[model samples]
Each structure stands twice: as structure tokens, then as C-alpha cells.
Target: LYGLLRRNFRIEEIQLVRPDINLLQKDDGTWNLPITSSDNGAGSSKEAMMLPFIADNVQIIDGNLTWAKVGETTSLSIQNFTIRLKIHSINSFPNMDLNLSVGEMDSTMISPIKDIKANLKTSEGLASLDNLSLNISGGSIEMKGDSTLPSKDKDAEYTATISVKNIDLETLISQFVPEAKELLKGVVDADITIKGQGFDAKADIKFSIPSLLVQDKIKIEQVKGNINYADFDFIISDITMNVFGGNVVGKGTGTLANISNPEFNLAFNVNNIDTGIALTALGQDALLAQGKLSGNINASGNISDIKADGKISSDKLNIKKMGDLTDITAPFRATITKQDKEVNIDNFSAKIYGGSVEGKANIIFGKDGQPHFSTTLNLSGLEAGNALKQLAGKAFLTGKTEGNIQLAGQGTDINTLTGSTDIIFKNGKLATHPIQNLLSVFIPALKTINFVAAKFLSTIGDGKVNITTATLENPQLLMYYGKGQMKLSNQKLAIPSHLLMRCDMVAKMPLVSGAFVREDENWCGIDFNILGTLSNPKSDLGDKLKGQAIGSAIEQIFGGDKDKEDKGGGGIGDLLEGIFK
Candidate 1:
């Protein structure tokens, strides 16, 4: 053999019989060969001893190899491998065919793969995988591919198609994402095509699923979609699913170029969604509301920032609270937008209690993750008695009301409230028992007075509500005016007020009318203070009359000066001036 040619050689056949080999892989994915001192010396003269050979055929039979990496429990074993090579000449590339059958392949990162079989062929620098099949996690995967080796002038190019069928989602995904095991259950299928040159690659993926259950709360049915990826970006289309008794369709685009802060733009349309089911899916009590909901949403953003716009509407929403159900008869509609930690709602409209409401609102999240909100609402022709009974479980007044309210607050506490309200009532009467009881002390006829018109104006801040003006008019009887502040935290009232009546009306009830002082030939007035909580009020009219005569008390209360009486400084002139001012 030493005397034979080393530059050119020919062999008809060579065989490897029942060989077993073990190889170590380095961290960088390169093999680490076992070399002794003598083997090293021989390898140093490898170029001089190298031979170019021509073989008609060569084969390896019953070969077994185990490959393992340093400091890792994961390893791959190939068994019962057979290979055949056919060579025509030393200058021509050989043809090779190989088949591998593995009884079992196991790794810590995935479940064992069983009954693996593969067939591969090669000519020159090109290799083709005719078929590769494996069973894993109660499912199977089939794959085929063609690849070319890289040369000095070009990068490797490859194409592959993979088919996955009925893979156990929880069993498979739990190996990589353990936390999701309890949150997910289902089976999945996919057909994927991948093509690439070196690191520049693209994939087209189509996936389908019969059903998926998430967190034991939501069930998604008939999910199907297709996605295309190229240049680190993904385009998704034709995605549809059913959940919450509704159908949803969606499309989107996303980028993975900067994976830490990847961006996405997505849109979704939902139709005929059951509101109770949707609320329950979001961890809320289903009894809160019931109706059908429809919506469209568009969103764009990166991980830490987002912007969204949408519209939502419903026609038959009924709210349930405290064993009561309130029907909203008109269609409900709202437009919503969000940026970062702030959300804005616009063009919100609804009808209830035979009245219409229109409003806009804004919400902001602070650094501490607490929410602050503000809103303005206009009400038209609302039945006050019905509104009060529905909202408060008691009817405090009966009338038709129109008003506008502007309010801002933090969290859910009413004590943080700051706002203003102006309201007008038509053809109404006070139904509060405490207020009626207090008024009866002034005049027996005041116990059940009906007002033709009433108005209230107030502003809220600093833990108190400032009553800028409050008036009631009964054209046939009397007029009333009041001003005061109410403590918001406790609903306590402190108001100074006056009741003015025509002398003719007073003369009709002379017994209780003694408390009224004649302010003029035509008018009689009684000044009093309203005290106590909003639910239980008290008056000081009896004490004032007992302490002094009605005329002297009235004069003293108004800074009496008979000498300035003619200058519009006292009596009816002064009382009207003070009330209006």
C-alpha cells in the first residue's frame, strides 16, 4: 500500500459493518474529534497523504451514532443507518443515497420522537429529502426539502414544505412554555412552505383548528388563517373565528425586525356578539347587562405604546342593578379612541326614562396606575320621578327636568368630585317628607305646595357644593329663594332662605300666617334657615317667631334702618335685592 499511488486511486467497493460511533459537539455547533498523539502526527501530513479516489459503489450498513453537546442533557441518536455512494471518476462528484430508521429520539426540550424514517438523495452539491416522517406528542409531521451546499461564490439556498396534523397543543407547547399548559387546550394543523438563501428567508403558513379553549374561560371555534413572512415582517389575512356566540374577522401586519419593540397594525370586525357571554369571558358578572353588541376596531402600536379607534353600538341594552332592571329604549352608540394611557369617548348617546342623553368623556391613567376621568352630559325632557326612582330607589321629586352636568373625579370616590350643574324643572312638586314637614310649620297650606317652575344652579369643589341660586315659583301662591353650601362627604345642608307670599294669600290662612311679617301693603315675608341632612331637614322659623315679633326679626335680619327705607334700602326691595344678588 505504501508503494501504491497516493494521488489517484480506484476502488470498486467499500463497506462499514455494524459500526457504532459517538461524537461530541461544541457550543458553536462544530464537532470535536477525538485525536491521539499518533493520529495528530498523521493528520499533520494530511495533504501529502491525501488521495483522490474513484469508486463504482460504496456502502455503510447497521451504523449507529450518538451526538451530544457539552453540558447538555439533550442528545440525538441515529440507528440502523445505511448509505450507498456511486462514483464515476475522481474529477466527478459522487451520487449518494441514504436511509435512516430510529427507534427513539429523546430530548429534555421536547417529547420523544418515535418511529422516525427518512430517505435522502444527493448529486454534486445538491441534496434532496424525498420524505421524512416522525411521530411526536400524539401527532405526526411530514416534511420534504431540497438544498444546495454553499460554494466560494454563493450562499446556500433551500426550500422546504412541512405538514403538521392533529398536534396536541398543550402537550407540545408546554414543553416550551410551561405556564401556558393550564391556559390552553386544543389540537392544531398547519401547512408551511419555507424558502431562503442564507439568512434571507420567507415563509407562507396556513393554519386551521377545530376549536381552542383558553384559560377555561373562552372557547374559540373554527379558526383558520394564512400568514406570509418576508424581510422580518408578517402579513396576515383571512382570519376568522367564532366566540362569545359571535363571528369575528380580522387582518393585520406585524414586524419582527426589532423584536424587543416589534410593531403591529391590526383591525377587527365583530357582529351580533352576546353581551352577557362577552362580559363573562372578560371575568365580569354576566348579569351586569344583556344585549347584542357589534363593533369595529383598528389599532397600531409597539410594545409600550399604542393607539386605537373604534365604534360600538347596541339597540336593546338593559342594565341590572340592586334587583332592578332599567330598560334603555333607544339605540346606544359611542365612538372611542385611545393613545398610550389615555382614552377618549365621543358622541355617546342613549335614551332612558323617556329622555335622551348625549355626552363625551375622557379618562387618563396616572403613573401609579390610578384612573382619573371627566365627562359632560346634557339631558333633555327626563322624567325626574322615574329617573330618581331608578337611580336612587326612591322618588324625591316629580317633574320633567332638563339639565347639563359637568364633572371630574379620581377613582370611584364621590368625595373627589368637582363639577357644576344647572337644572330646570317644570310643573313639579317636592315629594320629600322631611322638607314637607319643615314647611308645614310656616303655613298649613305649605305642606303640599305645587310649583309651576323651579331652577337650581350649583358648583362643586373643596368637599362642598356651593348653591349659587335656588328658586321655586307657585304663581297662585308664593315664591321661594335660597342659597347655601352642602357638605359632599355627609350630604349635610346649611341654607338661609326666605318665603314671600301675597297678603291676600296670607289672609286666607290667618292662624299660621302670624309668623309672616308684612313687607309691604301687598307682600308678607318669612325669613328662615334650613338645616340638617338632605334626607332629613329642619327649619328655624318657629324659633325666630318665638324669640321676637315677626316685623322686628325681619328688620334685624335685614339690617334695619327705617331712615333708609325710602331709598330702597329695606323691606321687599332689600329682600329681592339680596336674593338676586
Candidate 2:
């Protein structure tokens, strides 16, 4: 009988159950429920409907089924189920209204959803679902939607909207990002709309959050944004947030579909923010102090085409770097652009230590995808004592200093860095030195001058250092003047330079009121020369004076052979020899 009924029409094995049923369709004839058709054929088949067990309307009421099929596949099943069906003609589908519940749904392989309630209604050519609800790991959500029937080549059309409230982001983020969710605290509210036909779909969503904290170190007061998503492109707008007691505003559009050729442009502005807390919050720890920062910047494009231009300023700002605190009260400007995988810094200018510093740089990516950088810097107007203290944490000299520095290297760690620098100082005091060790080359008065003060000027460049016009005087010892040059390579020191100086010996007390010599003898200044390296330099006051004497004698000897070459050189040499004598 079942084989005959399935030849022309798709019929399910009907279980003549009367509710509270938990078994599959019974195989015995006793549980068989016969379905009959009406025959009244002028416009419709007119015939009295007769069910096998006898009487009434052509429908099933308070009926239960363990399984149902619409086609070849067994697609429906129910428990604690109640359905209303009315079938008038054998050629049309019956009206069906069903209410059912399930323990768990296993349709999604990633995670199982539980406690599903589906209320369905199908009539005419439309279908509607009401009160659809499910539970996820973090929270619960509800959905409502409707759909139209589909034909051969055309797909069903549908519209759906979802609401999410106070979902636990920690739980959600841990499943995806697998980082700490406990160090964070926040609540999320979102509204989502999805509409699709066939294989194409679009989504519009909005989010609002308040009082979010990360590791309890940084806090955001409010955040609001919206996104329009289609395919792989997104348009974001009206983004606003608060951090470090300042406001941040931004907007942009981008496409991540093609990673090699991304396009983006975002203009951002920040106002009167605390630099220390802001830097800390952004994962930097330079220990900035006593400054408020405000700036506007534009960031865009992929790595090969990235660019940035901005101006930043601070008032009386102090930064802790390399275990020293440096102060600055100046404005900074920077412009950067990238081309052919090389990043270029067109200009970077700032002021420090009552001076100005300016430079340019280039960064190229290596085979390992790390940056290799080369840069040049020029510094001026910096105090000698301050610059020394900033670089070495100790001040040995005091005056004004200027310098040029060049650097080139790769890697992110400072330990793997390399560079070279040059410096010059003028009119400074030597706070401390090894002057006593240099008594062989300098006068005894150098100790007293080093103890109190001195005048000095020096210039260094290209691995070579020169010192000129360093003078010292003392009544107890003698007056000394000096100049020299030195060189360095790979931090190894070598000096091959010359120095010319004069020393004055003072005669005082007048023998305690007894007697004395001439006025020139009271403070006899001598001519001298210094030779050799900074490590072991040699002085020759006797030789320099003797040379002057010989040169003078030779000049007199050649007075008859006077060529235009001497001009006043010989005259000046004669005057110096007479004064020294």
C-alpha cells in the first residue's frame, strides 16, 4: 500500500499519533492514517473525502509526527509538537502552522547553539518567522525576518535585523584573538542590518561604547562609530573618542580586499592632550613630562605609498632618555613620504638646549623586511656643559657647542646601532681634567687654571679634532696658552698635531723689600711649541725659542738678498725674537 501511494505523489509515512509521541512512524497497519481526496469536478474535483477511520473535514488536528519529508530528503522532525493542517484539494499544498522546540541545533560545526524556539507560518506564497531566539557563549540575541518563495533560477529574497546588548567582549575576543580579556572592561551595544539576494549581500552596523579600559592603564570615556560594508570595502564615518583628557576625531575609507594595493585616507586631530599618559597608552614609554600636545595629521595608503605630514609643539617639555632628563620648549615639524619601498624624510626640525637642530633621513627595507636607515643631523647653539651632561651624564667643560652627526644602520635595538659625530666649543671653562699629568707639556700654572677657570675654543670634523686659544694664568706658578689637534677611528684615539704657546713667569714679593731686576724680568714670557699625540704629547720651549733666534739671524744674513716672498713675514719674526729675548 505504501509503495503504491509513493508512485506519483511525495507522501510521508504518517504516524496516527495523538500527541505525547516520541517514536518514529509505526510500521503496523493499526497506526496508519489514510488521506483521501474530494472530487467535485466542474471547476474542481467534487468528491466526498473519506478517511480510513471515518469521518469529517479533510485535515489533521492535534496530530503528531516524528518525521516529515517534502522531497526525497527527510527534512523535519518534532517533539512536543502541535500543527494545524487543512487540505481541500489534492493538487495544492495544505496550510501549515507549527509550534515546536528543540534541545540543541547542530547545524553550525564550530559551536553548537541551544534552546531554539521557532514559530513558523506559511500561507499563499509568503513565509514569516516570529520570535526567533538563540543563546551564544557571551550573550543572547533575537532575530526577526521574512522571505519570499524562490523559483528555478531565482533565489529567495530576505531581510534581517539583529540587536546585541552588553555582550562580553572578553569572552568573544578570547575565542578569536586569544589574548587577555580579563585586563579589559567594557560593554558593547550594536545594531546590525543585513539584506541579500542570491550571492550578494551588504551590512550596515553601528556601535556605541563607554568607559573602556585596557590593563587598567588607559581609559576611554566614550566611543562612537558607524560602518557601511559591501563586498570587501568599508566606509567609516563620524568616529569620535576621548582619551588622556582630550578629544580625537577621525574619518576614512579603505579596502582590504586586495592586500597588495590598499587605498586609504584618514585625517585625524587631537587637542591639548597629556603627552606622558598619551604616549604610555599608545605603548611607548619615553617618560615625557610637563607638556601638552596638539596636532593634526593625515595617514594613508599601503606601505609602498605611505605618507605623513604634521606639526607638533610643546611648552617646557622634559623627556627622560638614556637615563637622563632633557628639556625642550620648541615646535617640531615633519614631512615624510614613501616611494618604491623606500621611505624618505624630507625635513625634521626642532630646537633644543637654546639651539636648533635640523636633518633629513632615508629608510629602505631590506631583504628581511626590516628598515635600514641613514640620516644627517646638524646642531648649534647648545650649551657645552648641558650637551656634555646630556650625552655623558657628566659635565667636564662649560661653554657653547655645535656639531654635525651622521648615522647609518639597520635593526630596531639600540645596541646594534652605529654612527659618527663631530663637535666644536668656544670660550669655555674647564671644570676638571688631567692637567697635572700634562705638566711635562704645560706650565705648573695649568693646575691653578684648571682648578679655577680657563678660556678655550675648539673645532672637530671628519674624525679630526682641533683645539685653539686655550689660555690660563696664575700668579704663584706661570701663565700658559695652548692649541692642538687629534683624530679617532672606530673609537680608537690617535693624535698627530702641533701646538704653539707662550708661558709667563711672575716675580713677586720683591725679595721682601730688598731688591729686584728689570721690569721684563718680573714676568718673563717665553715662546714654545708642542708636538705629538694627545696620549703622550711633547713640549719644546727651548727649541722653539732657538728656532726663532736662528730664523732671525738668517733673515739678517739675507737682508741684502731680500725677495718679495718675505714681505712682512721676516719683519714679524724679528719683532717676536726681540720681545722674547
Candidate 3:
């Protein structure tokens, strides 16, 4: 039968190969059975002898069967007849929807397997790949497992590009400043992008850095032009933000040149900034000093070309803190130099009482930052008596006065003030409402004084002020050294007579120097020491007393006691005796 089998069948096709089956004892009392294929097969001899076995259901199948252990040429030996399956190459497996598992069939097959990486494709039209070439040094996922194709242009409505960073910023900063936990109490959250057309702008902002304990120190580096909403094309970089309590406002702009070195260009214009609220927010005593400062304030400037103009007006400015008028207006214009930090007043004027004064002053800051001022002022229709009464009380001024004055001064402080000006008093009308008027009736010669007084009043009272000149020194002495002359009643009294007889005469006040005196709309005199600011002093006591003829001699001798004697004869005697005593 063996000889016949070899001759009747193709010996190569009929050859049977079997693996070497081994059973080894392990240290744990377990057994390891390793089944491996034999290198040499029983070609003719084995086939010839197994012919009878082949006839009894041990026939060779149609196709070839090749099998081996993953790393070894081991034919698995199991319960009955050993069967072999052959696969040409791993590429034969399609990379499609296929579910497969690989594992050892028995407990003895404990040899470890190397990683089996594969691409999957299936007959049902799905494909996937794991490309190992494009991986970063660190662990990263590099795979494409898309089940769908790219959308066509006609079917796409939006396109999005996203970039995500897995690094933690706060964790990184913590290494430098361990106390950052107490410093920065918040995280950074910002969304910035550059979209398609009309979305070219970009904005970056940071807020509430708890590590620094800064509520909101925001900085927007840049934003595209398309996002400028309010009809303004703002090109800014390094723009810092301001945060007060909870309110946030954008303040400074950065320099476009260097991204790190930023510049600030902020201009805030608040038409009505609630100063009361601002003061309260500053933790100040919240009492309304001035009702409400409701006006426009515009501050616009750059570090290089900074120019600011602000005008503040209130409905009624309070002098509560100052202890003065309850209501008044103070409007001023200020111009400051950015380079030098010097401030100059182009115009600063206010209307107080019934008068208006306009002035222009400049403040020159010294090396120590002290301010010196050179100011010029023009006052119109100022009521001198009213102003004096308001300033020093009603007891200081004896009569009402209407005049205009001009002043110029330059000083660093109030104590060292120096200035000069001319004051003109017009339409002088003496209201004969005082005690001195009763003495005018003594002598007939006094009638001349009366007529002269009346004439001076008539010319000045209902008319323009009769002041010919009233000059003041550098440091004005209101009543002392100021001096001037008057053409009284179209008559030239001796300069002395004119000055002594006239009710309103320009003269230096009695005690003070450099100040002028205008007495009762009739007489004026200058200080005898410093010649008058305008001219020499003048007086006319001789003509004044001579004109009151009849009792002039006796009046002169007894004029001092005459008033006392007239009060009451015995009273006058008692007054004289008391004086003698």
C-alpha cells in the first residue's frame, strides 16, 4: 500500500508536515507545552505510509494551509487532528470595517507578542490609517480617522479655524512667584480672532489677575479696523484699561513699533462727571461742597503732543467750605504745556456781585515746582463800596462808589505780591446820611464850601465820574498813596483850595502810603511823605476858612472845642475841664 500510494498520487501535494510538540515542567508546578513545526518534513516516506490513513477521512483539502506561531515556526497541536491555515502577507487584510481579536489559545502559549499596528479597510466602504511618521517628540495623537469626505464649496456655510494650547499659564507663573496664589485671584480669559472681510480687527484683554491682586489691568494689543464701531478707525496697540470698583473703561494705547514698550493716548471727555460720586468713590467725606459740578470737561493729549481744555460750570457754586457767597460763577480756561508741565491761563474771568473782571495769567514753575504768576486784570463797573462791604463788612465803607479799575501783578506767593493800576471813580454822589453833614451851617463863608460841594456833586452825580486821574503804585495802597487831581466846577481854585473844598477829590488816604483817597465826593488829599502817584499833594485850608468870613477867626481858634460846646454849654465846660484836668 505504501509503494502503491507513492506511485499513484503526486507525492509533493500529498506530503504531511507536523510540528514538534514539547511539554516542560515549570517552577510553579505548571506545565508549558510548546508546539513548533519541524524544519524537515516527511516527504515521500511519510506520505507513502499514510495513504491508508488518508483514505479514512484524513484527506488533504483543496487549498494550501500554512500556519506558524507569531515569532516561531510552531504548529499548534490541539485535541485531535491539527489543521493549518495560511496567509500570504499582512497587506492581504483590507483596511476597512473589520472587527478581529488576537490572543493565545492556551495557557502554555505565554510568549509575549510585539505591537501589531495596522491600517483597517473593509468591504463595506470604510478606510482608516495610523501614520507613525508625523509624531512630535512628546506624546501626541497623530491619526486621521475621518469617516466623511470634505464638503463642497456650494454646501459650506461657515469655515472655522481653531487652535488650542494644553499648557497651563497660571501653573507656569506659579513657579516664579509662589505667593501668586494670594496675589492673583483670577484667571485669564480672552477671545481674540481675525475673521474674513469686515472682521479684520483683533482685541486681546486680561482681567482680574488674582495673583497680582489687580482687579482689571487690561491690555488690548491690537484690533483690526473692521471692528471699529463708532465711525472711528482706531489703530491702537498696548491699550490699557481702567477699572474703578466694577466699572471698566479703556484708557491708554500702545506703541505700534515695539509690542512690549507700549504708549498711552487716552482722552476722556465727560460732559457731566458726577464729582460728588467720584469723591465718594475716593473714600472722601461725602458732603456737597458745591451743589453739583455739571459742565463739560475735555482732556485730550498724548505724551508727545498733549493739550487739554476743560471747562467746569455749576448751577450754583457753594462757598460752604470757603465761608463766603452761597452762589457764584467761576469759569476759567487753562492751557498747560506737556513738555514742561507749565500751566498758563489764556483767560480766567468771573462775575462777582455787580462787577466783571477778566484776567490772563501764566504760572511759571520754578526748579522746585513752585508756581509764580504774572497776571493782568481789567475790571468793569465794580461797585467799590459794595465790594468792600462784602469783603470787610458794612462798617468799612461809608458810601457807595462806582468805578472801573485795571490791575497787574507778578508774584510767587500772596505775601510777596506787587502790582500797579489806575482806578477811576465816576458819577460820585455823596449821600448826606452821616454825622459830618451837620457841621456845614456855621459861617456864611461855609456857604462857599456848600456851593462848591453842590457843584462837584452836580457835575459828577448825574454825569460821568469827575475823576481826572487816580494812579496807584506797584503795590497798590487803596487809600494811602494813590493821588489825582480834579477840575472842580469849571473853576480853578488854588490847587490847595480846589483839593480842600471839593467833596470828591483824588488824594492819598491819610495814614496809608501809595494809596489814593476820594473823600465824600468833595475833597481829596495825598500823603505828605511820598509825592502822589500822579502828582504832588495839594490843599486849600486858608481859602476854605477865609470864605466862611464872619466867625472864621474865632472858629479857627476854638474849632476843636466848638463841637463839644455846641452839644451843651455846661457839658462843653465839663468836657473842657476834663481835658484840662
lDDT of each: 0.73, 0.52, 0.32
For residues 401-510, could you state the per-residue lDDT of candidate 2 as single tens digits?
67777776654434334565565565555544332223322244443233233444555455554554555543444445666555533322232222222223223221
TM-score to true structure, per model: 0.62, 0.51, 0.36
Model 3 spans with C-alpha error above 4 angstroms:
1-201, 204-267, 270-294, 316-340, 364-369, 395-412, 428-499, 502-581
Q: Give the number of the best model, judged by TM-score.
A: 1
With candidate 2 superimposed using the best TM-score fit, by how many Å does residue 361's alpha carbon deviate from the native? 6.8
Q: How far out, in Å, is residue 417 in model 2? A: 5.7
Kindly list the per-residue Cα lDDT of model 1 for residues 1-581, writing each as its tens digit: 53364467778788888789889988855566522122345454322233457776777777777888898987877666665656554423345666666666766668878778888877778879999999898889999999986765788899999999988888887776555566567888999999999878899999988999876657889988998989889998768888889888999999988754567888888778887897677555677678777777777875345677777667767676322223222222222222225767776677766777777888775554455789898888888778767755666677888999899987556688899999888898866645455445546677777889888899998888899888888867778899998897877889999988888887774334677889987789888988876655667765654444335545466555677786756664454333322
Cα deviation of 495, candidate 3, in Å:
18
Which order, best to worst by lDDT? Answer: 1, 2, 3
- How many clashes in each candidate? 0, 7, 48
Q: Cα lDDT for residue 47, model 3?
A: 14
